[model samples]
Target chain A: MIRSIRSQAQFYYGGLVVALVSLILVGFNYYERFGRLKTLDERLDEQLTIARPLMFRGPEERPPPRREERGEDLRRPEKRKPPPPDRFDPLPKLRKEIEVARFREGPQGEEVLASLIRDGFYVLGFKPNGEELFRSENAPDAVVPWVNKRDRAKKRDRDSFQRWSGDFREAIQFGQGRGYLLVGTDASRLHEGLNELMLKLSLVCFALTGVVLAIGWILMGKALRPIDQITKVAQSICEGDSNRRIDTDSIRNELGPLGRILNTTFDRLVRSVQQQIRITADASHELRTPVSVILADCDLALRKESSSERKQETIELCRDTALHMKSLIESLTQMARWDSSSDVLKKEKCDLGQIAEQTAKMFTPLAEEKNVEIIIETTPCETFCDPLAIKQTLANLISNAIHYNKPSGKVTIRTKRIGKSNIIEVEDTGFGISSQDLPKIFERFYRIDKAREIEEGHSGLGLSISKAIVEAHGGSIEAYSQKGIGSRFVIQLP
Target chain B: MKILIVEDNQRLRRSMLEYARAEGCVADAASDGEEGLYKALNWDYDLILLDVMMPKIDGWEMLRRIRERKTTPVIMVTARAQIDDRVRGLDEGADDYLVKPFEMRELMARIRANTRRVENNPQPCLEAGDIMVNTVKRLAYFKDQAVELTAREYNLLEMFMYKRNEVLSREFIYDHLFDERDETVSNMLEVYVYKLRSKFGKDSIQTRRGLGYVFMPES
Candidate 1:
């Protein structure tokens, strides 16, 4: 539920740590419990195979007492040592007890002996000659026979072990070359030891999981701390400190590249927005000049001593000024529409040569007035393009060619196809732009000759608009000029 | 007042020139900064009105060039009305700042105020001896009684009052009385001076022996 990267990562790590530790603890508890129980069953089977034979033998007189330090053995002169603890060699004690009960004498003695040795276990044994040697009262009646049958079936005579679970939780193992053994341990002791082990393991696992979660939380926080710094900087920018930027240098992880990219994007956005603001200011400044001209003319006419001729001239001047402003606004509107991003272009099949010819004819009168010749050379170039947009773009180029050209200079409009591309070129033998002004000719409101262009009612957005139109049709426009020779504008269309 | 307008925009330059001339102030116009600086440094105009944004050389560059030669008063005219621009203009030795698309009357008033600095007085009327000229109304008063004179005579008399004890060259008087557009005969300046002397009395206008004339009347 936590959305923060640091918190989410810590949460997942904590859960994994807990699950992994718990699984390891449970597995170790089961393994230890199984091994302990198996070892206990094997030891008990060995003792049962050795002690039962001694129990059935009743007594042995030849074996000397292990505690005798002197040579004399007086049987009745010393107090009898109580039988030793039965684990190391229970056969001696079992033989004494069975002999006292006279277990071999009758069924009563056998019952007494069996009751004495019951001890929550069953035992059965048999000799190699297929005769039962001993069987407790609760011993399974078919234990020895079943073991013999299994041994024959397996085609081997060796010790074997088997265990069964549930209400009859015990182990049954069969014997060596002399006899067979069937022992059923209570199994409650193994279960009790396993339960205790699980409790202790759970306690340790809980503590370990806690430590892991804490360490994960700290590590995740360290990794994600740069995100906090970036957020703070972005917030500051939103609050109008627009120049604030993220410090990408201090970020030394995966977020480093992300921070650097974000900083670059922010820098670009800020620069573009500033440029837009500057353009608006320049546009307003441009509009002010024509308005000032109209106002000045009106002021001149309002003078009482002015003659009628002066007033009439001012009236004409005002009309012309108003017309110039209208054209300026129109140019501005065209550029604004282009900048707004939807009224881009409508494409269709059109001939580049025919359109160039038509555009040249359209500019014939202006060219004649300036005494600039218009020459068209084409190679029947046909391409998919927006005809009207391309015409307008060509007109802009031709107009600039004529306007900036020297008198009697030549303007050549040439179109040709070059390897899957259409090239439209407008070259003029005019006063070419200087090297410094060549790159910025297409920028909005940038003019090499500012005074003359403004006076001639050129809003300076012509080339910019032309660029937008040409580029909208998936083409590019470039300019090359040598100051004294001429300038060339080339448009490549695909 | 003779003011030079150095503005790159032709329409705005023409309007300001016409308005200044109509207001009875001799005015000259330049379409770009290069021409503006040339005229400004060459001529002895009372005040220079400079537009900040120009093609060849901007208003600031022009102002700096002019200051290197003389201490002519400059009023920077610009469409940039930002405070930083105004401060920069003043700090760069401009006498005043005027924003573009301005009222012609305000421009004229500011120009008049700056022209008074040329006379070393802060009032509208300039006085020397018993003669006084009201620069605003282009009117003259001799001993508190108004005198009738042509516009050229009044201009010549006002020039003399501003340059009181200094001798004026014939060419300087002619240049100040008429703008670049005016075509004058060689004797036009003498005629105006002669008429001014006849009205104000002979001793009031002293001719400095083939050099020029001076308005050093007996104190």
Candidate 2:
């Protein structure tokens, strides 16, 4: 399947967004885990500091009192002898009240250490001779074993805790030339909390990726809707419905310009089709007359049994008709060429005045025969255009002027510059066209004076050809006429 | 018969004129509708051959104007053979129609048919006493014996037979026999008349002193 631009964009953008979200989620998870672990480490360090002093003190400083000094039964422990126990403890519950005379040092600190162990911390103390000195209750089984192993390893560093863990958080602090103090706490709660957080983050990342992809799909479809419509219209036009055009109003965003351009192309296509149809009709109409004449002449000649001279006359008429047909065909071919290749003109710098003068000179003899005067007025205006096409147009205009003029009428061929264009005007004092026929004068096979036109052997294609040639050169030709007054044809070239 | 040809095609017009004259009809031609209309209005012709497409005034317009006052028969000859044009031409008072590239024989037949209708003669044969002329065949019979004659002689005999007892002036005869372009000597008519007399018998033609010759079948 071919992926449209919308799908491709969705893929890239969704991937980028999903990847970025996943990256941020992972980073946040890591930061949270690091902070939690750091806080736990700090609390463990404080716990170890409080327990350090109690573990390192000697135990023989104070001996326990005899059993009679209690003066009571053992069952009444809370009421009897808090003072006796205090006198025997070095790091006592009321250490502030114990004076230096009351407390005595001992050979081994077992009694003082034993009293310290009665506090609720899990602590172990080791002697310098690699012997176990004291251990508190409720310490994990791995703590004593690890402490004993550390004592034998004999790689002790003073004033620092050697941390170890097996399903728990524990740290063993070794004193200088003394045994180790091992302090431990459970760390399974922290591990379990981090695992829960990681599971939640994965779910969120998946949900976010799904949401982003769905939104991207919707947005991309909306944006590409106009483009899809334009493609459909273009496809239809390519299938030969020249009239089909993109609906510019319905198109939005940057595709609006594309729709407008397609519409313009469609318009050109429709116009070219119409032009082809008209040319075909005109060609058929124009060719029919000469063919009729030739047929008539040949038919008449064949039906008659006349002298050789008369027969020759009919043959000559046929020959003339054939020639007329030839010229008409040639004109049609030229028109077809112009229609097919609108860019056939080879533009060069040429003077309009010079072309006008030459055309006027060429028509002088014909004008004289009709008792019409030919006049030329030039201003030496220069312009860039197809010289051959321009010359043919000028010739057509000048000859039409002479042909339509009255006896002793005047024909003026003038060239000048007006504004940004060069203008060539052919003005005649002829039998001008009426308003009704003026607009149709430039159409092929349209003749105002059919008899006169036929008499002069005009195919009635001259003006239409001239118009085509002029338009091809990026110029315009217009005619202004009044009945019985005259007609003026103006050509403007830029 | 006298006819007017209003055709714009110069060669076709000339050919029509030649064929009409050969068919023993007096024909005059004009190059445009305006000139044709003027000539048609002023002259009384037996028929008019008008072309539909013309300058100054077209054949339809000319025919319209001519139909306004004159009921002279018109045959519209043109290159446009479309049914609509033909119907329009006929509706606009054309007695008959001929499309271009038409055989001259067909045109002559139409001319003869139209002229004969104008003269209220349905028969193709013209009779002046014993001299019976078949206009279609261009043959003359004197009492059941066929006489072979030149085209000009036949044309002369046909004219006399059409207007048997009427005195046809030499000037009128020359005018009818020749076209405008033909340069006629003064004795051309006399030569034709003499030839006709030798063949038909001199007593059959009578010339009034200072007048013209008349065909007298009873003489």
Candidate 3:
């Protein structure tokens, strides 16, 4: 019951019920007592009417002297003391004290009388005969009787009974006396108790609610703390801190899967970034050596005799080294661009025949110088692809062919359309790839083991970039070679 | 023949001087632009060897100040071997540009080429109106009276006399006078040309609107 009524509204309703019931119960009890008192007065009034004529027959047969008037030495003299003339009557002559004594004789009647008295009563009329008619406590009660009484100033013998002289005469004239009968229990004390109970309960409930809300807020914060930490770790990863890892120990519930996913992603990111940094550092390091060689060689040539014969050789060497440096720088810059965004192939509409012709033309002069036979076979093939990337791919393959070719060697470039795809092949009579390097050529910075000793300036990124470009263009590049034989590189673009 | 070598790099400068000496030319060396400018301004030289990238007033500024009072031929040397560098050097008052760590032979040939113009082109232009520039000797004859001209004025007058009727763009004329390094051509060229005109006669070089000045031969 207490739990159900623990809330503020329930407490208030419960208090109201208790207060209202007390008021109604006490009020009903007081009304029952008053009703009984009115019935007793009615009976007493009937007896008084029977005795009144007998006593008033002729004044010869007088009643005995009143016990309060005559002592033991006097003979009884009963003359109907003529009922006195009307004068003083606040209440009719009703015996109120006697009625109250009779009503108290019942079970629980004491409690009833106690309630009525606490509610308070009023006496309407009184006489020296010690009889009176009065309203019950709770004020508005009506059953009051009338009586005759003397009203003489000289009848002040302390023993001469004073009486209500006017009540019976007025009652006789008016037939019945009328007055209010008020019946109710006193509400002030019971209501004060109920008010005190409500106030205390309200104060307690407000404090409890405050404590509950504060505890709930704190619990929510504590529960989400690990998730907040995981969010921070994820944000760090977004900011390029690939080495950052989630605190697996602190993570629980659904976050365990999240932590595992993040760890896997970070592992992949670290590998790729490390690969790029190594390639860039290795390429720059490799380039510095050749540049130093060129500068040194040029300086020496300038210092020596100005023989025009040796001069051409030095200038050609310098130019070759410069071209190598430029390619290396261009490759590094492209890698940087890829790292910054996507490595996907750039696609555009390009004339493959034109590109092939340009490539062949560029290598023609070098081929003529070496007394080699160069041939180009192509159809008027056009495709959607990154023109620069495709051109670069072709240049790398053809230049590598020419660089490694022998005197009187043959170089052939062929392009053709095969079903919705364009295919290009570069074939050269040169030292071919070893079987071990065939698979690893597409890996960044992976050079051939045997070729490393002979080739000084190949950063090994050219084939990897070519492969990337081909894949980006939705194409593929493949190599087939045998040592001491020729090599062919085939590119297929869709 | 006398040549002035004004490179700041000691090794390259020494090597080039040796090459010049081998060509039977007296080569004098100045290690920086400031020293080079002082030497070239005070002495009469057939050629000046100027380095484009020099400290404490570069070769371009040195040549420009030198051209203010002297008409000595200058050749610029630079380490950046770009073609744009060569063009800029030549435009800034350099008669020639040679990129270094250059071939000693190339440097020598360019030097010979520049000095040849200085020694040969200004001679024997006998008439510009009533004036004759004597070829055999460094003398000017105007109306048969000896008319002396400062070196700067003579060079300016010589430019107008050569392209007598054609309008020469300010840029072309400035390049002719100051080479590529002397970038103050817009103002400096105007001042020098004005000085030359006032001495020779106001109407000697007629200004062509939206083009440049033209040397008009009176009909």
Compare the candidates by lDDT and give the number of the best one: 1
For candidate 3, the per-residue lDDT at A418 reads: 91
Pairwise lDDT winner, candidates 1 and 2 = 1
Q: For model 1, state the Cα shift of residue A41 in Å.
A: 23
TM-score of 3: 0.39
Name the weakest run of 10 consecutive residues (lDDT summed) in model 3 chain B: B174-183
DockQ of 1: 0.39
Candidates 1 and 2 compared by DockQ, better number: 1
Q: Taking the tens digit of each residue's C-alpha lDDT, what string does model 2 give over B65-133?
A: 999989999999887777899999999899998876577778888888886787666789988777888
Chain B TM, per prediction: 0.93, 0.83, 0.53
For model 1 chain A, the run of ten residues with the poorest summed lDDT: A58-67
lDDT of each: 0.78, 0.77, 0.62
True contacts kept of each: 0.59, 0.39, 0.00
Query: Candidate 2 clash total?
Result: 13
Ranked by lDDT from best down, the candidates are 1, 2, 3
Q: Estimated TM-score per prediction?
A: 0.64, 0.55, 0.39
